[model samples]
Target: MGILDAKALRDDIVARLLTDEVDLETSAYLDRILELAEMEEAEHQFLNDPFDRSVALVLQLFQDKDLDPWAVDLSAFLEMFSTRIEDTEDIDLPTCGRLIRMAWQVLRGQAETLIERQNHEDEVDEPWIYDGGWESDFDDNDYNFSVGIITGTHKERLPDMFSGRIQREEGRPVTLGELLMGLKAASRISEEQNLRLKIAEKRRASLEMARERFSGSLHVEDLEGDIRRTWEAMRMRANPEDQTCTLSAISEELADRSMESGTIREEANAEAQVAAMVATLFLVNRGYASIEQKDAIDGSVILTDLHPDESDFEELSLRLHPPPEIEEAV
Candidate 1:
């Protein structure tokens, strides 16, 4: 498809994503899954294997703790944290109790960062951020580098938190050749699920209600109201209007609420977490109010409102709809 067509399709999907709170929540879940999906086989075995699950959990905890990415010594860390038990029929490891300890200690009291250890800092130190040379055309001097499907972010701060070379189907976290692959495959299925809605209405009353709700007559009121409505529709216990929220926070809130209501709190899988992030990103980019994540740890995508005086909408108005440049007179 053409760029414009793809953009239009993306807009359509995004609009649908906005309308349904489930979509928002699911997208957030998917984002995390994509991050975990750094491993090519991670997703397939995640649900089935405990070791893979443990690794994903460890990775998430590492991220949530805001520990150094390069600090991770996967083999050593796994050795230290794994639960050493005799292999059972259900869970098959190489030998005795070689499995990830579910509740391994990560955070220290009043510590600014995740951990105090510097096990593998030297391994991460390299002049060029990228391990493999995918982009033949890229040079050392260019400020920003794009290699085919992937784009590098932390050029100035090489081998830092989010700096790396990659080509992913969708952008989420850094994935090396043998790491995360944040592939996002959605759209047709979502549309197919919604097909029944096109003709479900036996009465026009719902249409009238929708029209009344979305008159789109007022400017400021409409914008403010939309934001408020989105906040409401999410139905989160704590308001993220002015404060930052995280996947963990939302999970805790939802779990508590569910328990209080005597409903079982089902875990939000990797896909759901990743899906929820889409909504968060959408709100950050388009929601009139500016926001930021409370911390590097815990809240990955949930943003706290910044309430900037001037915004992209204000600054880009002229550029977006510029009058035709006056031609030079002959």
Candidate 2:
């Protein structure tokens, strides 16, 4: 009559077949055969105009017959027809029909084989009994899932199933120091951290050298100059301000010196000049040669016999005056 009516009639026939019941009605038998033929036509139409809903219906029909709806051998089907399947916008009608036919063949063959097996079993008088679970029959001596065998002395042992050969070669045990050294060498400390540690060590060494050089016996002028320059250098490197107190202490020492007021003034001037020169040298050594000379020389030299108006010593220069030539002996 129509596709749905034909499908319903075919479904009823298949249901009866599954339950081993038969209907002798000629109208039903004719409808069932006609439905199979109609399905073949529908399958071809599906191939040409694939639709998801239609493909799902065809898939269900094939599955009802216990057949894989995509019945072509996987490799051959993929090579020859997969692109068509993907390109189609409707269900694959031809493939569905082929799948239905294959399912019927397979089911029929299986049924025949099962019938043969049952007939043979019926002839057996004293059938052997099979234990329900294979595992339950196993004894302790049988291969166990839990326990595994280990071989050799505990110190040199390996799993029994391990394929590698074990040797009894004698050797002295590793010493504690050697083991510790190996571990230390393999530790995670980075090269950059090590480099920083080295730099810190060098800076400490340089500071110690400076302390030793400055602490030795020095003329008051030389001592004051060195301490001031050292303080400035430390400051440039962002060293602690506590180091600057060393220079202050040296200044205090110079201030404490007992001398004529004139001599004390002259010595302070000489000390300031020397300090400026030391500071200039320190800056030069540290690669700041372009540092302003005016700043370096400020208040760094002593002047005598100047007017009262020139008493402010802030602007004095530290440039060394050349030694005057001695008069030839008359």
Candidate 3:
């Protein structure tokens, strides 16, 4: 989407190169991707040669690497990526040019997906306690926080779901980041609740229908009519503008669209989490652009100075009882 910077991508691949420890297969694929990237960026029509068909398979591999490749089917993708190339030999210069362009598009999409997923996964869902001790409570448990946005721990949804939870418990001033974090959490929780309610209603209706079948009084036409009426009701409720999808699923969709941006969500001890949230708010309202959690256990925050021109007098004023006034040097 962005200017298709193939040279930059090629350089990036070269820098990483990847190790076989992860997956020899994926590593080899990377090698092929990098090779094709270099040739394509160099504007070489070398794919027209007798062995150029293999290059076509490599190019197809890029195209088949889309988000929902299963829709295209593995056999179909295999044929397109590898076998389909066997049919073409001594391809024309124009075709070679098209293949080069297509290869760039495919590889770029795959790279964008990698970057997008990594960015989402890295979101700062900070530890609820030091050294991940919170894991002990919910290690094998799954949470259904408002539904679709289920996290392994409430920590994922809490800061985002309820700001008051953070404020009341943490008892500290909240930060803009913390507020945004809570809004995002709340939005996710709301979406999940909607999904859950819809799913529950559907299941309940199915159960009622199953019970009705046991009564054995309904004719086929009657059953059809009932189904049709339900269908009509669903159609009436379906709004094209309604976007009540799971937040992570929405995130995955955005990734497929080749764009990316997100934020970290934090949830500590309700008190600890809320305290950190409030502490963050304190710094944010004071013209601090950001607050970094240095020690959540101790409710410490670094109010990032967005305006370096200003002094730390505000920061100093927040300080009190410093080393007991150094005993006034006695």
Model 2, which residues run further than 4 Å from truth? Answer: 1-153, 158-185, 188-199, 208-266, 272-330
Give residue 186's lDDT in candidate 1 (0 to 100).
28
Q: What TM-score does each of the candidates earn? A: 0.20, 0.15, 0.20
State the lDDT of candidate 2 residue by residue for 212-294, as single tens digits.
53333123535434634433333433223222222223232443342334445444533433343344344335332322212
Q: Relative to the unseen true structure, what is the C-alpha lDDT of residue 209 in candidate 1, on a scale of 0 to 100?
A: 46
Q: Name the regions of candidate 3 deviating beyond 4 angstroms.
A: 1-48, 66-92, 130-330
The clash numbers for all candidates, in the given order, read 27, 12, 12
**What is the per-residue lDDT of model 3 for residues 1-330, given as tens digits with 9 covering 90 to 100?**
111132333222222222223332345455555455556543333443423334443445446544321111222222232332324332132343455355445545644554554554455243232243322344222344434355454556556554443343435667546767766986787677676666656655654553443233111223323322222222233233441122122222323322222322211111122122233344345443344443332222233434333344334334521345344565
Candidate 3 C-alpha error for residue 13, in Å: 18
The residue-level lDDT of candidate 3 at 54 comes to 41
Candidate 1, residues 163-256, lDDT tens digits: the string is 4655544555454532422212224444543553333332234444433433321112244333333333244433545454443344344345
TM-score of 1: 0.20
